[model samples]
Target: MKKQMLLAAMSLAILSAYAGAAPTDKAADVPLKPAAQQTQAAVWASRVLSRYHYKATPLDDAMSEKIFDRYFKSLDAEKLFFVQADLDKYADAKQKLDDAIVGENLQLPFNIYNLYQQRFAERIAYARELLKSKPDFTLDESYQYDREKAEWPKDETEVKDLWRKRVKNDWLRLKLAGKDDKAIRDMLDKRYANYMSRSRKLNNEDVFQIFMNAYAMSIEPHTNYLGPRASEQFDIQMRLSLEGIGAVLQTREDYTVIREVVAGSPAGMSGKIKVGDRIMGVGQGSTGPFTDVLGWRIDDVVALIRGPKDSTVRLQMLPADAGPDGKPVTIALVRKKISMEEQSAKKTIMEVRDGTVKRRVGVISLPTFYMDFEARRKGEKDFKSATRDVARLLAELKKEKVDNVLIDLRNNGGGSLTEAVELTGLFIDRGPVVQQRSAEGKVEVENDTVPGLAWDGPVGVLINRGSASASEIFAAAMQDYGRGIIIGEPSFGKGTVQTLINLDRFGQGDKARLGELKMTIAQFFRINGGTTQLRGVTPDIKLPTIADAENFGESSYDNALPYTVIKPAVYIPAGEVKDIVPLLEKKHQARVAKDKDFQYLVDDINYVKKQRKENMISLNETARRKERDQQEARAKLREARLAAAPSPDDPILVPDPKEGLKQAVSPKPASAKAARQAAAVKGASRTDDGLQGDERSLAAELEAEKAAKNAKDVLLNEAVHILADEVGLLKTDTRLASRVLPYTSDR
Candidate 1:
């Protein structure tokens, strides 16, 4: 099954910045050890997690105290550099890290990563000696920048007053983003000397990829280990080619964030780089100099934002809805490549009126369940497949008669489980579409011997929290065969199933490289037998998103993998969307309570869940400039009530039923008085590092036209008005349209 349909396409796109040759600041001052093939790759990754881990867990002593508190929170995850007496001097090596990963003993995780590189070079030499001076912005202190779950400092004078309120919250976030005080002390002394030259370039394969991914995520969270330079960036993201600026990066502490932009690459068509932004300076072409990358190393800021495919790089960023007193911006882009036709599956359509009846709906989107499996193993009769381009966009939306389709799969994050069981046999006309099991128990299923129905009308899927794992196996087999209407926000539960392995083919002849593991040998279920693992696909219409499910997906992985059950397989019900979901949730909650853009997206998902539950901030500069001027006066009154409302319709494109109707136009609307006259001509061209050159290209063209009018897909325009109110209640309910239509006697 192509190794059980290889699916971990989680795409953390660093594309090519991890396979060795980077240690030269005088070989980053030596010290880091254990690389003679990482003690037999940590005893062959602790006997492949005690023999093939589909959560057979057990590396005892409570998984070595959860791999010694996930290797000191993967080396200080903001509990800021070691203190509870440096974790009570290895608190007796927390039950001996599972007998030092089954006796290969990498000297207590390289002496707790050499005392977290000596308390991260003594907190970057006390934050470059508190950037020498200025920091009394009218007292009234507050910092606690969400120390993950706080607690550590009970010594070194409470860890130098938590690095003096983290260098006064990094000089009150560059003095509320306008800098000056000698440009925030020359950018906090080159961002604490690029955090002591990236914590003196942490080597020994970066402390054996942070103690074998803190003992492979303490036995679960998708068992990893990758190291031989992240197994060559996981085989260059499984051959979905690459080059650069297609973003997807992580290392959060000293920020290099921006996780996932990629879609049509050049950082997703430069909608000015988003996904929790951050980057903080890279710069190369058209005036190079920038560099600062806060504290580098997300593989050296992805090898300084990888280059050469049509050059230029730039970046700077910060945005993710501003907050650390915001204003960073910059951008630029250019680099290219990223295409599997920019992660394939396309289509569009939308329409949805209903009063005088406009309906249409189509959509498709997909974004990853790709195939090209080496051009279908070289027999290439037109290969690149997401089920042969969504079965040719469901036969060109059934020759443009498009009544209702949808799909989308929100931020997809999944790929080829045989193209999610051949794209769930294009709207099910067959059986068993997903069940797996493995780690020896054995189950299997995966059917759909492709027969008919590639667009069994009135469908809807969508999904959010970044969909996931074969997009939770095609939205849990279209919510267990009542084929479609699983709207939004729930899916990323990643029901197990990883595979990789390779450790240089168990290196017996000692070629030394030994890397890849990925592991989690199979789990997914749902052919009615439950288990989208830690509870994913729950959407018969649960919209208003901004991600929370206990803080973003797979139940925010504190060692994920739980919700079980299995044994239903023999399938059949391809119809009945739960008797029209309470009349499509009473006409989708009376049109989202008179939708002012879905109440400005439920007031921006309740102000991002009240700023993710307020983890303290106010380092006072007049209460942080009156909370950044009341968040830019509630974002200029939600962009002047979305520029006095009434916009939403424009989706059209879907027409290639042999090129019949093509003119769809749209883009040209940024109003709120041209974003308050591009914020008063970029506030008279701000300087201390805010806006520059052609006023930062007219503030990145009014922030890519207010991020294309806040990327209006308002939950796929309420899943196209709930699939056009289920195609206007199945055109006067023919027994709920003969149990959910689809047998159009060969159209």
Candidate 2:
């Protein structure tokens, strides 16, 4: 008999259950047996988790039940398939999952997955049949697009009805986009066929990965099982480089959408691709026939796009906001290597004049805490690292006689752990930056060994929800030590530490290479006895964000590790900025109230929030058209209002070598002379007009500068204003000087 151990790692427990979902029609029984390698992987993964995972959750009835529910949810999150009857059929496995793991019997999960695949195929067929007839656009019904909270259909008839409405909605959306009936029908057919094809391609490994992740994620959202393909992708991303289009891709429903276009990359420089645009097809080169990627896996799409540097990859993409009838546009991009220059720390100087104080605040925007570990091991003199690059930026800023420094960590998703520690060291002299508490109750303090500070000045840290891990660590430490004032939305609360364990290291014989496990091995704690866990580091000064609080942050994840506190590390606080912050906040509030752009930002955020709250959309074509028209009208009105708003006073002519702040006057509204010259050129009467060649180049340069100046970041402008206030406050308050001691052991 296999021994069953009750491994209770954390005393805390989540009280809530998974939301209730109604049942759909039962799926036809499909028997499944795990492949030999899959069984071996399961057994090995279980042992690894027990020995290495921070929260070694007991693989008992409780865990098994959670895994069962999670696995089903993973299969059909929108409650499209698998009714109560199917759940009843898999009831034995719900509790016996623990036994299966221990006895190395992986048949149960595979069996459930096989049944899910069968149901998926049936649903696709039903949807295809429904698409045979055009949807009635005159109906005044509403489709609950968000089905996560809704119950599954009770029977085949109900499921078919839901699918009918879904297909109708899909057709209506395309029809509204101006697609013809024949085109809409063809598109729908292709889409359904694609989904069916993808379902058919699902293998035993794919099923195992999905089930394994469900089990792992139940312990903590960050603890994940990376299958071989996913592991390789993770490694590529970690390298801070890849030879590709330089855009992150993710699957949404059936389309592969661009998540983010990396700066300095071909796609970003081209300025053709935008976030949320869906790629429908990809071409090998300019001449090659386009490969329709509809219903393809994200990995497969990535494989098609990523190729040799300087090679051309053509994408046929649909704009995110494009209607079903919207025509796809082809964009040809020359693939290039994503270099460290794209991800490295960059510097700027924003000269703020608050009543003639002339505050030259240095802005260092660190995109990631990156370090070329391999280069360092090879003993390269200039091995690229965040700390070294930042240190260099700081020195340049000092040479420019900057009054204060603002570290912009917005959207920095973190990288090297060692870099976060070393980067923190640059700001303060010899102190504990972050503490790591391991699974076996071992506390390791990562300290700043250097005794002298690289920067000792009034500092500000700009953060947002995208700032996570290493970014959070640096921000939290600065907040805890009172070394810098944090501005913006709360940071992404990811305090737990993850270690990627190679399964191949433990394997033997033919079943060796079994992907990897990115398990939570420890949790990080700030010097002030607080963890930047679920409640990420809240900024000292808050900024209004358009992003819904519910849809984002660490707390949004159901299984995120809870926040906890421990004994504070022995360290001196930087100073008391608590009292002065209110003053800064008051000033900030006053400035933004009078600022037209700030008002617009707030209005936009409110508009987005209102739209997000609305889940049910009308199916009536007239109603949707009218609503869309009204929205467009409102947007146009806002645009007109902004255009009428007064432009900033003529650019400050003080030449400050910082590229971002060069004085560039907006071009005068097109001169009559230039217009007349354009007409002359059209009539072949002004071949030697002044607006040609060198003059034309100068005109383009001026126009580009004007555009850049107009698009200056309003939030960063406010941050500079706040930093200017902080600098002013420090200068005026004499008693405050002793309290705000420059990096030293003295209190």
Tens digits of lDDT, candidate 2, 643-714: 684444211223555454453221111122222322221222111121222223333544744564555455
RMSD of each: 23.1, 12.4
Per TM-score, the best of the predicted structures is 2
What's the CA error at residue 735 for candidate 1, in Å?
Answer: 27
Q: 1-747, model 1: which lDDT tens digit per residue?
A: 253333433543343244443333324445666766678878877787787777677678888888888888878887877888878878888998778767876877887888788778877888788778787878887877668678888888888887888788777766777767897787677767766775676677777777888888777776778776666555554445557877767655567667567676788886877776788888889798988867556676777788779999888888877877688889888888665444467776867667776888877777666665555787869756777888898897788788888888676767668888878888888788888888788898889887886776778888766677887888889778888888877766778777667777677785768777877788878888988776778888788755556645677777676787977988777777788888989988987888776776677567646655786777778987876777677667666865674554434344555556543222111122222222332232122233222223333555755665444555677777888888888887777877766454234
User: What C-alpha lDDT values do all the predictions have?
Assistant: 0.71, 0.71
The TM-score values for the models, in the order shown, are: 0.34, 0.75
- The worst-scoring run of ten residues by lDDT in candidate 1 lies at 665-674
